[model samples]
Target: MRDYLIAFLTTGAITFVLSWIVWKVAIRYRLHPEIRERDVHKTPTPRLGGIAMFFGLVAFFLISTQLPGFAIVWEQPIRMWALLAAAALMVVVGVADDLWDLDWMIKLGAQFAAAWIVVGIGGIQILFLPFGSQVVVSSWLSISLSILAIVIVMNAVNFIDGLDGLVAGVCLIANAVFFAYSALLARDFDNSPETNTAVFITVVLLGVCAGFLPFNWNPAKMFMGDAGALLLGLMMASSAIVVTGNLPPQLLADNDQFGRSQLIGAYIPMILPIVVVLLPLLDFGLAVIRRTAKGRSPFSPDRQHMHHRMLDMGHTDRNAVFVFYAWTAVVSLSVLLMYIGTTAGWPGLYLPGLAYLLIGGVACVLVTLPPSRRAARVASDTKASS
Candidate 1:
């Protein structure tokens, strides 16, 4: 408890102070995000908020390692160093894009490099396979799987950072939940060093996001831009991989009766990440499908995201961001309840969370008809000008 408090306060303070400094730099450099024809923001806004987040993460880890309660936990600092290295790479790539507007292919190549740095060099890969039988993936397969997961998570988060404070807010909540799970896992599993590392990273991430959220909220002073968003996504994904990758095999065993059903149950925790981040992944998928169908690049920007639909439904920017925030909270809380209810001897609550996903996903679809479909003539005119 004491260690968690120290981590939270330390990281939060570092992130807040650094973010303020970055905001000032953004103003000084006039690094503003322009309101394009398809943009939802009515005014230009400064970017490079990610630079501050990067500093916050670096500073927090540096300071926390020296604290009495954190010293033992920080003993194996190689993993942390690897995370920092990956973040630094992403930050540079993101900053370059924000300033110079790099092409999509170049940005993507950098993302792959960032993921590989951690998976290949950092040695953060899930080896154990629990599907009614115990197995470990080959080194090559693990490397490929880790890189793919990290890249997907990194891009999903970047793509979701469209609205004010959305990514930061969602990340804070997600990390908080992950922190709880880490602590719970730590409490449940005694023979693993990964638990402490997982908790430490998640808490630091939570603090980093908390520090950035105030600056990122509605009527924002500056955007995290690609740099902040990509770094954040990478950090979150990296933490998830570390935490679950180290789980004990017995804990992952499937509980069902059917041969295949039991196998699937064992993979639940491994699969939960994709499910947890389904919104962003689904949104990205839809965006690609929509763009490819029209012979346009998927990277093309437009006001056709989940947040944009909220805006079309008469939500102000703040309201729209908040609405999304509320949805994320509900989904997260529902999942928590389901996890608790099922584990603590009650199985009824799981349905509610699954139901919510179906309802919310359908609502998002019904409301967010593509801008091309809903306002085709207007879209054609807008594209013509662009």
Candidate 2:
């Protein structure tokens, strides 16, 4: 934990300094592109913040080399180095798209390529299902599914990069939850040095996101742009892959049947990662379907993203970002608590976590839609204007 804290503080310091430098350089050079009609912000903001994040990631990698308990993690250094390579590939592709708005086809190709770098070069495929006695799959199936999952998550995260601070904040919260899971896994579940690998990367992610948020907040000085968002998604997917792939067999077989419900303590490790990105995946799936139905490219840009809808439904920019934060926190924390309870063999946490999930979800839905609130505001505005 002390080592992890050092990594976090180191990453935060480096990322913060780099973000400031990048933002200033971008501003001085007027590197931002002209604003588009559908864009929310009036001024062109620098989108090169991802450059700082990439470098900060590099710093974390450097520090990781010296950290204790990493011998198990670094036994085959290729995988970790390959992860860095994949991130560099993503950052380059992302930077190009950020500057020139590269064709969606090109960006998609790079995304797949990045995933390949991780899976093929890194040799980090999802070894087996992390639950129900660790159901193993064929090698080809593992690589294919791992690559596909990486691509899906990368795009899902990128798709939600519509609001300032939205991606950074939501990811920060999501990683915070996963970081806790990994930490507990290290100290409790298996007590293997290997679990610390997940702890290491997640805290690094948490730190970078924490550092990046101040610059990314509403009325922003800069945006992480596509590169930062994609980089984030890739790391997130990779971290989950690392944890599940390396965990000891029989560690996750809490339930024989993977039932569908909120109190899914046995499946939380697998489910929580997916749930953290649930909103992004939902928005991604909906957008692809919506665009395909209209015979348009799935990556076509529009003003109808979830964040945009939140705005159209009367959420202020910060409020909308907050709503995303709220949803992420509620879902991720609920699952984390359930896992803690189940693993600790404490009083049952199923009902309590379920209650929180239901209540928080209902509140999120109300705040998200709020039809009467919108209508009343409309009426009030019309009356005031008249």
Candidate 3:
């Protein structure tokens, strides 16, 4: 307990100081993002905040390793090194894009290449299928799946960075859930092999974002730009893959001694990554669907994002951010409840998971309702204008 507390506080303080230092540097350099087409804010904001976040993550990992009980995660450290390398690649690509307006193709190519390096050279692949299922993929398939996951998550985080605090806030929530799940797995579930790595990465990620949020929130002082968003996305996705693929088989054996079905009783927390990250995934899905429907490039910038829709409906920047924050909280709490309820035998495990999906589905509708009405009024006004 004391170790965990120290880890959290040490990481948090390191992140804050690093972020503040980077914030000052950005101000000095005038490295700001412009209000371009499809932009959500009116004022230019510093775009290299990710630089601070990167340093913060590095600082946390270093600090954690020095503490007792955390040395192993840094020892060998292939996974950590791989993730850091991938993150650095993305951050460089992102920062370049921010400064010089790199085309989407180049940006995407950079992301894919970085992901490939991680999975191929670093050997971080998704070896498992669904939780507790023996249906594992071949090494080739695992590498392919890992690449696809990385790409999807990279874009999801990048796209969701449209509004102030959105990306940082969402990452914080998701990592928190993941950290708790990993900690529980480590403490209760026989201190599984995958526990330390999962906890370490996610804790570092949470610390980075914790340091970032104060500068990112509404009427923001600094933007994370593509560097931060892409780096964060990759880290989150990589951690999820690691947690789900490695933990279950070791901890939740398909034996009769436990008496509980590993399929049902275990793997409940497997849904944490998905549920906690529902908003970005949903928004990314909608963005693709809407853009494709309009005969436009999916990568093209547009004002059809969830936050944009909220703003179009007259929600303030802070309101739009908070509304999404509320939804994120709802999904997180629902997952926690489901975890507890399933353990207590309140209902089947899938029920709570399904309940979470249903709630997110419903919230999606409620949030868009105001925007729908606003759209009607906009059309009516345009007709009058013509």
Candidate 4:
């Protein structure tokens, strides 16, 4: 626990410092692109923020190796090296896209390459079909599924990067939830090297997002561009792959505390990468459908994103971002609580269900309220009086 905390702080601190430096360099060189019609920011903002985040991730990994508790991670050099190489590939693709506006085909190919490195070289791939089912898949199937998961998550995150602080905030919440789940598994079910790796990856990811949030928040000083967004998505996917693909079902089956049915349900926490990313996936699907119906390419840029719709509905920029944040938090925490209940039988399932109702109700009310009704009325009265 102490090592995790140290790793988190170390990574965050380094990222924060590097972000500041990168912002200065970008500003000096005028590295930001011209604002496009679909963009939210009126002014040009520097990008390449991913450079800082990548360094932060690498720094933390090195620091973790020095820590006595985390030193064992280095023993499995292939997984560590594979993850690092994949992340480096993502950073290169992202930087090129940010600077040169690389073709979508090139970016897609890079994503596939990164996914291959993770599955083929790192040896991380989904093996089990479901929790209770004894169905095991072929190596080819596992590899294909792992690559598919990585690509889906990468694009899902990229799509949701439409709003300031949106992707960072959502990823932060998701990684935190997964980190907690992994930590719990390590403490309770399995203390194996695999679980430890998951915990380490998640902790580092949480730090990366948290550190980058300040610079990427509303009225932003800089954008993460494709570099940071894709890198974040890759890390999140990698953590999920490590946790879900590596942790064997036999561990849960061996535990006498859960029945067969309950054990099946317990797989919810294990599959959190899919569950927690529900919003982004939904938005991505909607965007694809909306685009296809109009005879546009699925990757065609547009202003119909969920955040854009919020702006269209007259919500302030900050409010729109916060609304999405609240939605993500509610969904992630609800899933987490329900998973806990299923695993430990402590909190009731109704807790998360009720939380959903409460959060959704509040969000609806907030979104529907007129922005600064009192202020608008005051201005009108003042004009008349004058």
Question: What's the lDDT for all of these models?
Answer: 0.75, 0.83, 0.76, 0.81
Off by over 4 Å in 2: 130-132, 254-266, 371-386
* Candidate 2: residue 205 Cα off by (Å): 0.6
- Per-residue alpha-carbon lDDT of model 1 for 255-352, expressed as tens digits? 22212234343554565555556667777888888888899998777678767776776666776666566666556655654454444444443566
Error of 4 at 120 (Å): 0.8
Per-residue lDDT for 241 in model 4? 78
What tens digits encode model 4's per-residue C-alpha lDDT throughout 134-237? 34668999999999988888888898887788888888888898888888878877777777888899889888888989999887888888888888888788
Model 2: per-residue Cα lDDT over 1-386, one tens digit each = 67778878989999999999999999999989889877888888999989999899889887677766456667678878888999998899998888899999999998889999999998878877754556786899889989999999999999999888999999999988898888877776665544666677788898899888899998899999888999999999988887766554555554323232323534577887798888899999999998999999999988888989988887888989888999999998888777766665556546667778899998887677656686787799999999
Model 3 shows how many backbone clashes? 0
Task: Tell me how many clashing residue pairs each candidate has.
Answer: 0, 0, 0, 0
Clashing pairs in 2: none
Highest lDDT scorer: 2
Model 1: per-residue Cα lDDT at residue 266: 53
Best by TM-score: 2
| Residue 261, candidate 2: alpha-carbon lDDT | 30
